[model samples]
Structures are given as C-alpha cells and as structure tokens.
Target chain A: MSDILLEIKNLTVSVRNGKSDIPIVKGVNIEIQRGEIVGLVGESGCGKSMTARSVMGILPGPARKSGEILWHEPDGTVTDLTGLSEKALRDMCGLRIGMVFQEPMTSLNPMMRIGDQVAEVLRIHKLVRNREEAREKVIRLLKEVGIEEPALRYRSYPHELSGGMRQRVMIAMAMIGEPGLLIADEPTTALDVTIEAQILRLIRQMCVSRHMSALVITHNMGVVSALCDRVYVMYMGRIMERASTGQLFANPLHPYTRGLLSSLPRIGKNPEYLTTIPGNIPEAGREPVGCEFCLRCSDDERRCFFERPSEIETDEGHYVSCFMCQRV
Target chain B: MSEEILISARNITKSYSLGRKKRHIAVNDVSLELYKGETLALVGESGCGKSTLARLLMRLIKADSGRICFEGTDISALSGRALKPYRKRMQMIFQDPASSLDPRLRIRDIIAEPLRVWRVCPDKTEMERRILDLLDMVELKESMIDWYPRELSGGQKQRVGIARAIALDPELIICDESVSALDVSVQAQILNLLKRLKKELGLSCLFISHDLSVVNFIADRVCVMRGGVICETADTETLYAHPGHEYTRYLLSSIPAIGDDPVS
Candidate 1:
C-alpha cells in the first residue's frame, strides 16, 4: 500500500461577492504520510483553518472550493474527494477521517451525556452491534484518552468537566471511528500552558499508537517543534515555505518565515529588539498584484514588486517562494 | 538594588457567595509590593484570582479586609470623588481592547478622554497636541486619530488602549492580560512598545498574565499564585532557574519550550 495517506493538489477557495470573487485560500499543496504529524503554521486570517476545513469538505457557506483532494486507502484504492457524491463524502467523513476544533466547549453538545456523545459516533458509522457493545467501547475509549473514573465520567455533562477533561472527551469522540487521517485546528490555542502540554502529548500519543496521520493547525511554533515532523508556513492564504521542522527552524529561507520565527519572544534570552513584519495582513481579495508578501518584505527587490515568484526547491524536499531566495 | 516602593497591598482578601451559603474565596490574604519604574508580573492559571487581585489593587473593587497604599497614602478607604486624584495617577489597560474602547468614539476622543476627565490639558489645541503625541508614542499614525475603534485591527486597537492609559501621565499602569489576546508577532511589537514607554516615561507596571514565558520576558519580579494564594515570589531569573514551590515547578515544566520532544 502507498504510504501517502492524503494529498492536496493546488487547492483554492474563494468567496462570491457582488460580481467578484474574493480568494481566501490561494493555490496550495500539502501531503501527509501514514503515521506522520504535519504542522500548518500561520497567524490569524492566514487561511490555515480554512484549508483544514476544505480537506474535510466542511467549508463554511458562500465559500467555493476547487482543485483535487485525493485520499489513498490502505486497500490500495485512491479516491478523489472533490468528485465524490454528498452521500459518499458524508460516509467518508467519520469512517475514514476525523477533525478536532479549537474550542471543544462549542463542538460538544452541552445537553448530551459524554458517553452518548462518543457512542453516537460509532452508531452513526454502524461500527457497533448493540447498546451493550457500544457502552463497552465507549468506556474503553474514555480510558484510552486518560480520563479517570470512566464509569463516572461516562454520564457527566461537558460542563461538569474541566477544560483539559473536556478536550480529552473531544479527542475520544474524534478517535472513536479509528480514522486513518485526523485534522486538528488550533487544538491547544484555548488551553492553559499545563493543559496545553497534556493535550498535545495526548494527540501525539493517540496518533502514534493508532498509526494514524495528523495535520495540526496552529500559530505556535513551540507546539510545532514539539509535535510535528514536518512544517508548512502559511501566510495570507498561500504556502510560503515547507520543510522538515529541524531544517525550517535552522535555516528559514523565506523572509516572512524568518520574520515569524524571530518575532517570537523566548523565555530567557531576550533580544535587544524584535523584527516585526511592518504591516498587518492584507484584506481578503486585496492582496498585492505581484508577490503576496512583498508589501512587508524588508529586502524587497525590483522584481518582487512587479512579478510573482514561483516555488523554488532550495534543498531536498525544501520549497520556498521568494525572488531574494532565488538569487541565493 | 533597593528601589523605592510604588504601591503596597497588605493582607488582601476577597470572596463571593455561591447562592447556597457557600463562600468562594477568590483572593485570600495575598500581599505584594511593586517598585518604582519596574515591572511586577502576577502569574497564575485560570480561576487563580490574579485578575481579582489586580482589580483590588486598582481599587476597582473593594477588598474584604486589607490596606492598599499608593505613594505612601492609603487609598483603600477612599471612595468616589476622594479617589479621583489617585485614579489619574493609576490607570489600567484591559485585556480585550476592542471591547474596552468605546465604539462610537474616534481614536482621538478615546485617547483624550482621560486628559479631559482629569483636566490635564486645558484647551483644545493642547489636548490635540497631546493626543497626537500619545499616538506617536504608541507608533500609531496621525491619520488613525480620526478612525473609530471598529475600523482598526486587534493590534491597532491595543495600541489605542495603551495610548489612552498613558495619556494622563500615570505613574503606574495595571496591564491585566494585555498581550494575551494578541498574536505572537504583534505581541512582540506591543511588548517592545511597552518597554520603550516604560523607559521614556518612568512608569511602573503590574502585569497580570497566565503565560510564564511572557512574564519571564517583561517582569523583574515574579509572583506565582494558585487557588487564591501566592505560592512563591522571587526575582525572575531566580524563580525560573530554581522554583521554590512545587506548583511553580509544575508550571515551569508545563511551558512548551522549543526543542522539547513530545513523549511518544
């Protein structure tokens, strides 16, 4: 079987306005392998979350998506997700793939018991035979997520649990279907530092134990370095750079990527000053005519203001798009 | 260096009733001191009462039993008009700038409100000049003075918040999770701005936040709190290098440091 579990090819998403289309997610490509944890790092309004939602076929209303999303099954069958019927897509959502959102409080139904919520995933996929079987599976899944007193927590509402425990329940719900691929959008953004560490560890452990793949969407580089094997830095709906986590951090090629890394404030070593990107992200559909990041590039050249730079492979599996990088 | 103390809170405690005769202790007998022209960080997790402590120090809410002295004068018992002069000396920058700013007012008016309330700037031209100067101090453009809060971005709104807080030339500013709502890059910009302003204006700050890494960057002294009580207090370097309390150690361990490997 092919090790490539999910592949995104030139995916684009745009919103329809009055006689115009506002491109939110420009053409971008990403690949996730079996048992690999990949990071999609970007700030707010950078389209990282939108790209993840597109992978799940859950783009919000009025947003039109295009391009190919290919899912390679363990049985050697490759399916194009964009061409699938609504019924087929619905079936594939829970059985073959799963997603975790930033805020678990809103994702979970406050009215329902935690046990029924996890069991509902199994029942919807027709994975369990009866109520007794579902109860046993739910208890085991809760325990697997490191929830103490599975029997007691099974009947507890989401409000009764703390933020960390609620997130664990959300993880249990997502992993109940034994999906081959998972998409997590800012999974630890709303959590405290201690709780964030636990959640990140839980996600990594679950993925490794199940031999599943993940696409972690976050703006935190620390989280990326700790959990992700590879990283893609996104900016204003486009992928500016992609490389292994170590390579990306050691030698960031793109100016935007370098600015982002340098702008982070560390604990001990305080720099004299931080390098800011000079300006805020451009409004959607109002990006520069040439390079999207040219407005904020400190070392902008003449060509950068007039011509868009194509993706250049600087090293093995390391890609960047910048006129300045091309000269090197 | 034995610096002059700016404000002192002695034996502060606060509590709220939980409907059925149960008392929820938000803050319990916590005392700390802020020095002149230095930053003191109050670090804790959610529901740890760091924010409640800030409110009590600012006198936004009365403490159950305590004495707060600002510049050697007890301000805890002062109320209404008696507190007006102290209010001008101590200002606050809230966490959510978007909500804290008045949406109907322009940036100029928003910043000039403090000066106008205190009668610091006598006339229109003086207020206009100070407003412009304040905007420039925060690195905001002169043209943004005419813009409303709703028209600005998150970082821009926060800059406006800082401009307003420093408009009255306050001696101390209480920044309650001021940078928590910002992105990393923008947070850096704001932090650098605050550092510059502190040096130029000789301002003392009480910065309250849940993120220890941020506290390490800006704080000269760190106070770790949990469950309405202070667990440890020490210099930033000492506290980070060798935590005196178990909770402080756990919090230090919990920060997602770069290059730390996730357990498989």
Candidate 2:
C-alpha cells in the first residue's frame, strides 16, 4: 500500500480570449501523502485557487484544464479525475473528496436552516437512511466542530450565526461526508484574527482526528506556518519553492520566497521600513520567458531574464526554481 | 514626538436602532487624542466600533453625545458652510481602493478633482504640473496618468487614493484600513510610502486596522477596542511588550506568526 493520497502531474489550466488562450496555471506538480497537510501559498491570480478548482472539477466558466489528477482510493484503485465525466465527478466529489471555501455566507444557503444545509451532503451521497438519521449525524458533526448547543442552533439561519459560527457550520458540512481529502481555500481570510486562530485550530484538529490529508490554499504566510506541515510557494502559475515548513522558514532559497518572508511585518520585530517586492504580478500570459519573478527579483542575472529555470533540489527534500539557486 | 494635540475626541457615543424596540451601540463613550505628526492606531475586531469611531472623527456621521475638536475648535456641532474649511484640512483613505476610486474617471482627472474643487491650482499648466507632481510623490508612473481605475492594480489604485487625499495638503489623514486590501508585498510598499509622507508633510494619521502586526509596524500608539469601547491604550512598545488589558493580551497571543508552532 502506498502512502501517496493525491498526485497532480503537469497540470495546466487556461482561459480562452477572443483569439488566444491565457494560461492561468502552467504545468505544475504536487503530491500529498496520506494525513499530511500541505499549503499552496501565493498572491491573488497566482493560480493557487485555480489549481484546487482543477482537482475538484469545478473550474469557472470559460476556463479549460488538462493533465492528470490521480486520486488513490482506499481499495488500491487509482482514479484519474481529469478523465471523469461531469456525472461521474459529481458522484465522487462529496463521497470521496470534500472542500471548504473562503466565504461561508456566499457558499451556504441564506434561506435554508443550518442543519438541513449540512445534512444535504449526506442526503445527496445517500450516507444516511432517513431524515432522523441525517439530523442526528448533523448534530454530532456540528458539536465536533465546536458549535455550542448544536440542537438549538440547528434551527438557526445562516445570518443568525456570527462569522466564526458560520465558518464552523461550513467545516461541519465539509466533514460530514468523512472524505479522505479535504481542500480548504482561504478558510480564515474573511475572519478576524482571534476567530482566524480558532478556525485554523479546528481545521488542524479535524485533519488529525480523521487522518485526512488537506491542501490549504492561502496567501498569508502566517496561516501556512500555523496549519501546514509542508509548504509550496507559487508565483505566476509555477511553484517557486517547496519544502517542509521548518526548512522553508529557516532557509528560503528562492528569492521570491525570501522576499515574501521578509516583507511580512512580524509581531515583535519592528523594522524601520519593511522590504518590498517592487513590481506587481504580471498579467496572465504576459509572464517573462525566463523566471516568472525575474521582473521583481533583485538577484536576476542575464540568464535569469532569458531562460526559464527548472526546479532544482538544493538540499534534501528542498526544491527551488531559480537560476541563482542552480549556480549555488 | 510633540505633545501638542492635533485632533481630540471626547466621550463620543453612537448607537443605531436595530428595530422598533431594540438598539445597537456602535461606539460607546470613547475618548482619544492624536499628537502632531504621529500615527495612532485603533485596533479591534469586526463590529468593535473602530470604523464607527473613525466616521465620528471624520464628521461623516453625527455622534449621539460628546465633542470632537481639531486644532482646539469643536467641529462636531459645525455644519454646512462653517464646516467647509475643516473638511479640506482632514482627508480620508478608504479600505477598498477599487470602489473608493471612481471607475469611469482617468487617473489624472481623478486626482485633479480634489484640486479643482478646492481651487488649489487654478491655472491650466500649473494644475497639470501639480497632478504630475502628485503622481511622482506617490511613485506612480507618468504613463499610467491616462489609465482608468479598472486598468490599474490594487496597489496603484491605492497610490492614486493617497495622492488625492494629500492633494489639498491636509494636516490630518484618517486611513480606514487603507492597506488591508493589498497583498503583503504591496502592503509593505504602501506602508513605507505612508511613513515617508508623514515625515515630509507633518501629517497626523488615525490608522485603523484589525491586523495587529500591521498596527505594531506603523503606529506609535495603540488603542485596543472591544464591543464599542476601548479596553486599553498605550504606546506601541508598551502595548506589545506588556499588554495591560486581558483582551489585549489575548489579541496579541492570537496572531499567527511565522516562527510560532503549528497547532498540533
């Protein structure tokens, strides 16, 4: 039996314009071991969310995707999600894989009761035999996610709960199916700091107790540090760096990754001026022929501006894609 | 830092009617002071009345009770023509740069609107030169002067917003989560720009934010607010090092720093 739960190979997602295609997510590879929490960190439009959407078979309108999304089943069966039909993917989604989005209010139904909305996943998947069974399961899951008084609050509307409580309901909805893989895309971005800590803790707890792997997509490095075991730094549709959390923080090889870490305003350390990446992320399909970060990278050389750098293993289990790293 | 007060709020309170019989207090009996050329941060979670306090200080809404003074003049009660001059002296930068900027207007015209309304530059060439100079001050390119807000990135739009806020050389600027919408790298750039502008122009700022790390970076003083009331107020160093209020301590601890251990 292999430990690999999900493996994405040479994935590419693009959108068509009038006469041309704009590549949002270029060829990229990511692997998640069973029960491992990996982070995909990047700025907006950097294709982190698009990558997640590709795996879930929920790419937005006009976007086209290709390449392999291999899902390793518990019974030694390997299923390629990209080859699955719409109907087949729908069957596999809630039963095999679950996802939580950033905004709970928009993702959840405002008109439906919170309890019914959570139980709908079970009903669709046929996990519960009857309405009574669904209600009991939902109350238990809601309680597990830390909703105080699950039975009383089950009748409440989405608007009746606070932001943190709404997010808890979303988590319960995602967890009810008992999927092997959970994808959380910026689950705490819209939350307050105190509430964000609570949500992150809950996600980590859920992943650990169920022994499920998770792919957390976010731009906040702090969130990555707090939740992810391994981190992948993405920039302009390519993975700039990948390593374990400790190594990535202690020794960031990619200039882009280093720049991001340095730019963050630490809680205790107050520097006179924060280091900044000078240029904005280039428009999709207009990235430089060389390194995608070459325009803003301070360590760029002639080769860095002309040839795209390939991923190189600088140390054990640490990978970086930069001409500078290759030379060192 | 000078001890001279730039703007002061005294016992300010604001409440909204939730329904026919219920009321929600947004801001409650809050008092604050901003010294000359220093940044005072108002830190709190959502629904904590930080935004409402900012609105009260900006005179965007009338307070239920208490007074607000700018340069020793009580402007809370002033209105219409009498309050016109004070309005130019105090400007604001909003959270969402995309919506705060006029989408249809070009960058040049958007910045020039403030100058034209205030008659800062009446001559044609002078106005053009002034607009270009303002763009330069904010480190924006000359070519982007003709671009619309939709064509610009989030950071560039925010730069444009700052240029307009300072077009009249306002003495005070109220930044309502000004850098919250930007990415980390861009947020750093904007913060440095704001710091430089404060030093060069001697502008006092009321920086409101929910992110504590940001507040620690840019603010000289900090005020921790909860449920529409301030729980603690102190210098930034003292506040971060040894929080007096339990709520303040909890907020400082809740921040997820890079070096902190992952929740196991």
DockQ for every model comes to 0.56, 0.63
TM-score of each: 0.97, 0.98
Model 1 chain A poorest ten-residue lDDT run: A266-275
| lDDT (Cα atoms) of all candidates against the true structure | 0.90, 0.93
Candidate 1: misplaced stretches above 4 Å? B260-264
C-alpha RMSD over true interface residues, each candidate: 3.2, 2.7
On TM-score, the candidate that comes out on top is 2
lDDT of 2: 0.93
Q: What docking class should model 1 receive?
A: medium
Per lDDT, the best of the predicted structures is: 2
Per-residue alpha-carbon lDDT of candidate 2 for residues B52-114, written as tens digits (9 for 90 to 100): 999999898999999999989999999989989989999999999999998999999999999
